[model samples]
Target: MFALKMNVLMIITIIMIMSFGIFGETISKTNSETKLIADLLAGYHPKVAPTDNGPVQVKMGFDMSYFDFIDEPKELAIAHGFVYRGWNDHRLQWNEADYNGTRRVNLDRNTVWVPHIQAANSAKVTELLESQVLVFSTGRVRFYQSLQIEFLCDMDLTYFPYDKQSCNIEFGSSLYTTEHINLTASPNRGTNGSRVNSAKDFQITTLDVQRSEKSFRFIAPYSFVDVTYTIGLKRVSSVYRAKLVVPSVLTSFLILATFLLPTASKEKITFCSNMFLCLLLLIAFLHTTVTSTVETVLGQLLAFSLFVDFFATIMAVVSYNIKNRGTSILTRKDYGIMLQDTTMDGDSGMRAEKTLSTKFAWLRYIDVISFIGFSIVFVIGLAAILNQRE
Candidate 1:
């Protein structure tokens, strides 16, 4: 019985030690966590007056190089870069000495309140990688978010192929009024301005960038501050020059070259007809791809080729008629000359035939002159078209 009592005493001692060990482990885990929970609550809920508070200045910027392909069908521009915005709030600032110089803490997005700023014409948000909130020793709170977006651009393709376009990306708050958030084009301030550095080291790709501060109103009486980035994209038309311009010029030259053929050669008409058909085919192909609402330089060149082909066809037909209807002999009196009215000699008929043929020789000269004239016009017009943007 003494041995059993001793065993019971040992069992109680073991149980008490195990309980104390578990309790200490639990305290170690909860002690730091409880403090963090308190910090999260205190950091997010800033003690600002509920009324329409003073302006919250926001600075905004993005890298220019990430402008990828343009989506014409959807009127969207795909861009990828660091997009960060932050504002200062004194209520969330801290005294560094209280936390042993550990004033900043990263929090989940759900735990924080972010300005409801949105891309007015955005289509897709491909990725939302991360959101960071940091508090500084001076009571400054800065927030950051990195994302990829496909935003809308009112694409004007009037100069397509050779067109320059202006595209805009606008961002403004929906819930907050101007009184609560008077935004600035500069979207970062104080602490965030130094750390993220997202907008600072960006290179815009083939765009003339301009930052503007604007204001717009919704159903509410107040106006929201909006920042806009306007970019101009100039077309590089080397492909178009090869596909449209080169062929157009060659086809036009062929139309004029038909003038060198004999007036009545059926081969000349056949060749012009085939060449003209090729031009029409080219125009058809251009129409398929060049669906811009406004006509482009390439379109003009296509139209010009059609006109030249029409004129060449007319000349070809005229040549056939002139050759078929041999020129009629004219009397000497009709040639502004006087001839004696004596017995006609046998040579008269042959002489008259030769004279009539010589008069119609002017047909060849007309063809040559018209060809040169039209070709000169085409070349001059071409130089003007290509140099438009230069």
Candidate 2:
């Protein structure tokens, strides 16, 4: 039993020794490779372009992770993503076999020549990754920078909640013109495994990338390459319809109901006044919610409501005046009955009664005409609003 225990201990010690030896060798090899990479970059100038003759072609693209938020009033959209850039640096190339088959090395971004690319329409940009890059032995350099970018979006809110908007993000070299650098779109540029199609009140419908060239005059005309990413967004309007449209429509019906009330009753004017206040409140709510300076369907609806309110209130006053005039002439004490005695006073009373009846007929005519006019206008306006959805 003592000899068996001795053998077991010997085996364990041998295994541990072998493991340490392997680990030491790995560490030594890694250090040697790192030294070799350092030696290769000893005389390199990071500010100089890695080319001898023509412009260096940089493959650049964006991989969108998700949408953060969209501020409609501010016309800003925030997105989280990675900016990918690749180029060849011939000075950094080395034989991998001499360094124990080391194919890739990581270097600090500050120690290399990087293109000065920026978003032209961005309000602000925040970096969210470590400042490092991957360098391959074949002279290929790759850089990935995670960024949270806020892009300026010029939105058209004509249709408001049902509106479709297109926002553009422009990327270009800020310092170097086409003479020193050429920008090319990477083939794999676009959304990267992101399932987020909706953000807050908008849904992404389309993403398009395009390349173009623009001329800028510094001392002379210098052309620069620009890559633009267009994002198509459609507003999700279920909430707006419930909060704005449905309520406005109900209030419109209430405005029409003012005309349906008895002309003699004082409630007609009171109803009109209440509806005017309600319409004012709705307008105020709309202004607070959607701070757009453009003309919109909801704005048109509110304006129409005001016009209907004014017309209804005027008609209500006219109706009250007519009722008062009829009452003064035909006393309720006599139950609006004319005397049959053939006298001058009786003739005058008869004529007054006829005039009162004519006035009542005109009041009815005004109510019918105003109601029909407003109803037709409301239907046309609703149709117009619906047609604006695109």
Candidate 3:
């Protein structure tokens, strides 16, 4: 029993010693990496570019994660994404053997030379999340930052609801010209295999990356490298078609139906009045729902509705007047002669009815001509609106 107890104590002592040795080794290696990082940044200047001969080539890319919203009135696109920038810094290089095989190290972003990239056409200033700089033993430095950027987009709502828009998000160095820094598009310059949650009204159709140099008219002519990401957005028009277009067309047809009512019916005027009020309400609804900056297909439809309403109103008034009050085209002498003739024949009622029919026959012709004319106008307007689709 004594020997067994002694053996158990020896095993525990050995385990404890091994644990301390491993722990000390880990601390020693961490210290070595810390010392190596300090030595690398000892003579580094964060503000200046790492290259001494030519401009530092920054390979940059964007990976979009979410599309928050697009404000059509403000012409702004807000999105969440990651920005990747990588370059080489010879000063941060070290031999792995000298630092206990430390091939990579993470340093605070402010302690290293980082390219100052910004969106040139941003509607709001973007603040990037704080992140670390990854430095490899081969002098390659990589940086990643998450940001929410609001970019200004020039919108044309001419074909709105069925319209497709192209918005550009341009990124470039804020202070450094092309002579000091050059930006290039990295291989992964898009959504990077991730699903982007876009807005309900819009679907992302295309994403194109273009690199160019733009010259600025400073005291001296300076050119800056620009990387622009063009996003093509197509509107989901199902709601507008159901709510706005279909109703507007039905309202237009109802205005045409106003002419079909009997000339003697008092409901003709009331029907026209109702249609006119409906058109006014539709126009008001359009103004409230759609952007008023440009003329759209719906706008054209409303304008045509006004003309149809005006023509219908005139016809309704004429029909009511002719039906209620006898025509005065013939003079009183002619009527008196007809009355004497009818009295002599003792058929005055029949003759008087025939005279009234002859005078009011023109009302039927007016209704037919107006209906045909307005129908032609409606067909032409619909064709034009349909042809505008791109």
Candidate 4:
């Protein structure tokens, strides 16, 4: 009897311990925390035409890149982390093929493309692989749907103490057009071999030209969080014309004014030189004003300014020399006659006239060159800008 009682007590104690152990294991499994280890990458696909009784289709793809995932040591074990999914938004304007065999543009769904994972696993907890996904839409879509694709990743909390990795998402689309949409290519769909005009849907509205970025640090391990980045570019061709006409006219007039000034007033001649300096400053200011708007084409404007400054300075030098070395016409007309009675004074007048003639001759040539050069530059630059507009 004593031996049997001892055996029964030992069995009861063993059962209780086994029950508690199993309960503890279940609690630990249920409470294991997780972290999201994947980033969003997405883009849209080209539209297709319908054939036979089959529906036409469009496809968009999203690539999910993951990091520090739960180490599924078993090669065949189902590891869960991410999925690919999308949403359909609305139908846009569309038309059918015409008599010429060209179909009208028809976009069926103006929907946003979203990402959800269908299946996922890690080859190695340390290894990162891009899950390439292809999402399809029917050809009934017309006018092409304007859509935004999204990606969401879920992390497994079972793996803790690992840092999340940074991620990037980029997208591009192919062009889709029907012949009816493009009159030049009648009877055929408007599709270009060049990627630029392939899909009418991926064309962004001007309002959507700006890009956006978002980022945040995950403070809690095994917690689910998401970050997004958006990129957009504008399709624009603007004609830029630096108004050389205004500055050129101002500069030309200043150069012309130099000729109107008296030759004898050292100050008057220097004033023409000063006008040239002012032109240089104005030209410099104009170039600087446009530098930010048109960076690549500024070399021509600089060259133009330098050309004006060089000739203006030279004219200033010539004028200064004439004024200092030659007799003033007024001085010669009044003083020469007064001095004519005396041999010494008359000889001086003759010498003065000769010096004035020699010194001012270059002035005439300078005037001609400057006027022609300024006009040429102004007209050429204006003409080039006009041609570009065409």
TM of each candidate vs. truth? 0.69, 0.88, 0.87, 0.33
Cand. 4 TM to true fold = 0.33
lDDT of every predicted structure (CA atoms): 0.62, 0.80, 0.80, 0.35
Cα lDDT of model 2 by residue, 1-390, tens digit: 999999999999999999999999899788877787687679877888866868889999888767744666777789778888999888888888788778889888888888889998899999997768798999899999999899888888778767888888899987888888889889868733335445768788777788999885763566888998888778788878898888977887678887788866788888889999998898888877667623887678877888889988888887788788756665434534443334437656777667667658877877888888888988887776676554
The global Cα lDDT (0 to 1) of model 4 is: 0.35
Number of backbone collisions per candidate: 9, 0, 0, 37
Q: Compare candidates 1 and 4 on TM-score and give the better one.
A: 1
List clashing residue pairs in candidate 3.
none
Off by over 4 Å in 2: 68-70, 191-194, 219-221, 325-355, 388-390
Model 4 agreement with the true structure over 270-330: per-residue lDDT tens digits: 6656665765665565445333312322334434555665655566676666655544344
State the RMSD for candidate 4.
Answer: 22.0
Clashing pairs in 2: none
For candidate 1, write residues 1-390 as lDDT tens digits: 999999999999999999999998778555544465476467455434223356766565554335544545456677655556666655555555454445466655556555667766678766567666665556455665566768877655544466566667676776777677766654332112112212211223233223444445544466666666665555566757787767876786777788788765788888878987898888787766645522666667667767877776777788777756654333466743222335556476556556666767887887789888888987876775666453
Query: Residue 265, candidate 1: how far off, in angstroms?
Result: 2.5
Candidates 2 and 4, the one with greater lDDT? 2
Residue ranges of candidate 3 with Cα displaced over 4 Å: 1-14, 68-70, 125-128, 191-194, 217-221, 322-354, 384-390
Cα-based lDDT at residue 227, candidate 2: 91
Of the two candidates 3 and 4, the one with more favorable lDDT, higher being better, is 3
lDDT of 1: 0.62
Candidate 3 per-residue C-alpha lDDT over 1-390 given as tens digits, one digit per residue, 9 for 90 to 100? 999999999999999999999999899899988999899989889988876868888999988777745666667789778889999988888999999899899999988889989888887856577789999999999999898899888877777667888888899986888878889999857733236778888888777799998776772576888999888778788868888777888898788887778765678888888888888888888776666623877677777877888877888887778756664444446554443343445455456657877777788778788888888888877666555455
Q: Rank by lDDT, descending?
A: 2, 3, 1, 4
